[model samples]
Target: MIPIAKPYLTAEDAQAAYDTILTGWITQGPRVQEFEEKFAAYTGAKYAVAVSNCTTALHLSMIVAGIGEGDEVICPSMSYIATANSIKYVGATPVFAEVNQEYNLDPTDVEKRINSNTKAILLVHQIGMPADIDAIKKICSRYNLKLIEDAACAVGSAYKGQKIGSHSELVCFSFHPRKIISTGDGGMITTSRKDYYDRLRLLRQHGMSINDRVRHNSKKVIFEDHIEVGYNYRMTDIQASVGIKQLEKLDWIVTERRKIANKYHEALKNIEGIRLPLERERYFSNYQSYSIYLEKSFPINRNRFMQELLDNEIATRRGIMNSHRETAYKHLEDKVNLPVSEKLQDRSVLLPLYVPMIEEDVKFIIDTILKLTQLKTV
Candidate 1:
């Protein structure tokens, strides 16, 4: 079956990992530092911190931003659970906000959720689509709230000509296999503030006064001190080695994925019962996951549609999740009402999208989807 997504790794990626292993410094070391520097330069950020994964990146972002228990962070519930989970990690309340047609936090609804307890706004660039950062920034400025970005799926996405990671003060990115880039499994946090960069480096490695690399290179004995409570969230040099190669291929990956997505757009635009993902002016999406929404009056429901694709040797996944509906956040069901988000979650389906896709497979997937929708041709 054609899979929904796959990492575009080459023999060179494996070689990078192999080379790092032979260096005898597999943990966060020179490679990690090099990866961080390259990533920061690529995204136009002053500093970048590598972590275990995007979740930990978000956790660190919250800590450095001074979010704590009793504080509330406004965020959209129509996102991966990790988006809200990160807020919970710091004992802060996650105030669910509504999403607009673009499946991003609606600035109007976000403004409504603001209260005295609200400390920050965690904006997500869902599925590689850039959110309205400028609009949200205005809200933050007016209310003295911090803005943190969950750019897990937006590594190659741009907004108003600027990369996602460079726009926000604290932006978290994922290098999961399913994301645009893969570091096996790793994350990054980019920031312009020196204070945040210094503290994040310390906090990611148990808050030790000196990092392992520094101590290892020292000629004299060095005793480290734990300055504060911190978590073991460092990325290994092995992963960083792979990430360096992945970073080099990111632009090409995005270009290839967009080519596939455009094919889908051209073929499926005429289908009356489905809606395609949006790419508004000035917002450049990497099309991380090509999701199409089935209208309420569509011939088949979301589950059946996905099942049909699977039966035809084309794999598909349900749309973005609604964190508010999950058992972990069930109590939020009564507290929040997100009509747009709920409808989006229930009606949308993620189609297969990846780099290095075979032309025939892409055609087959498109033909099968068209047949299932009873269009046969577009």
Candidate 2:
């Protein structure tokens, strides 16, 4: 069966891992530092901290931003549960907000949620589609709130002419296998501020005054100090090595994905009850996920529609989650009105999208969907 998403790994990626493993400095070391520097350079950020995954990146970002108990972090209800969970990790409450048609936070809704307890606007660039950064930034400025970008699926995406990481004070990216690039299960946080950068670096390494890299490079046996409580969220050198190679091919992968996305867009545009994902003005998405919203006008319900796709040997998945509806977050349920987010949670589906897919595969997926949707009209 055609699967939903897969990594574009190659012999080079495996070789990178092998070579790094052979070096015996397999934990967070030179390769991690090198990967951090290279990623920062690529994304136009002053600093990048390589971590275990984006969830930890978000958690650390919240801690450094001084979000603590009684603090309310305004975030969209429509996102991976990790986004909300990260806030909860820092003892802060996640205030669910409305999302726009693009499945991003509505800036006006964000404005309404702001009060003295509000600490930051944790905006997500959902499914690689760039949110209205300018509008969100203005709101953050007006309310004196910190703006943190959850760029987990937005590595190659851009806002206006600038890349997503470069525009935000704190931006978290995932290197999951499902993302545009994969480092197995890793993440990176980018920031222009040296203070935030240093804190992230220290926190990822057990709040040490001196890190392993510095200790290894030092000519003398220098002891380290535990400055504060910190988590062991460091990314391994083996993963970082793979990430470096993956980063080299990132642009090519994105270009290929976009080519396939365009074909899907053209093939599916005229179908009834199908609402395609949007690339808003001045935004450049890498199309990490090619998701579509099936309106209630459709003859088949979401479950049956997915079953049909599965029977056709095509894999599919539900769209971005409504974290508030989760059993773990029962307290947050029905606490806010997020119409667009709720509608999407029930109706949207994610098609297979990855670097390995070519034009023919995309065409096949599109054609199959067309035939299914056309059956009712017949």
* Best candidate, TM-score: 1
User: Pairs clashing in candidate 1?
Assistant: none
Task: Kindly report which residue stretches of model 2 are placed more than 4 angstroms away from their true locations once superposed.
Answer: none
lDDT per residue for candidate 1 within 253-282, as digits (tens), equals 999999999999999999889899999999
Alpha-carbon deviation at 147 in model 2, angstroms:
0.7
| Pairs that collide, model 2 | none
Compute the lDDT of residue 255 as modeled in candidate 1: 94
Write candidate 2's Cα lDDT for 252-371 as tens digits.
998998988888899889888899999978899999898899887776777778889999899999878899888888776757678789899899999998877866777788888877
Model 2 TM-score, 2 decimals: 0.98
RMSD of candidate 2 to the truth, in angstroms, is 1.3
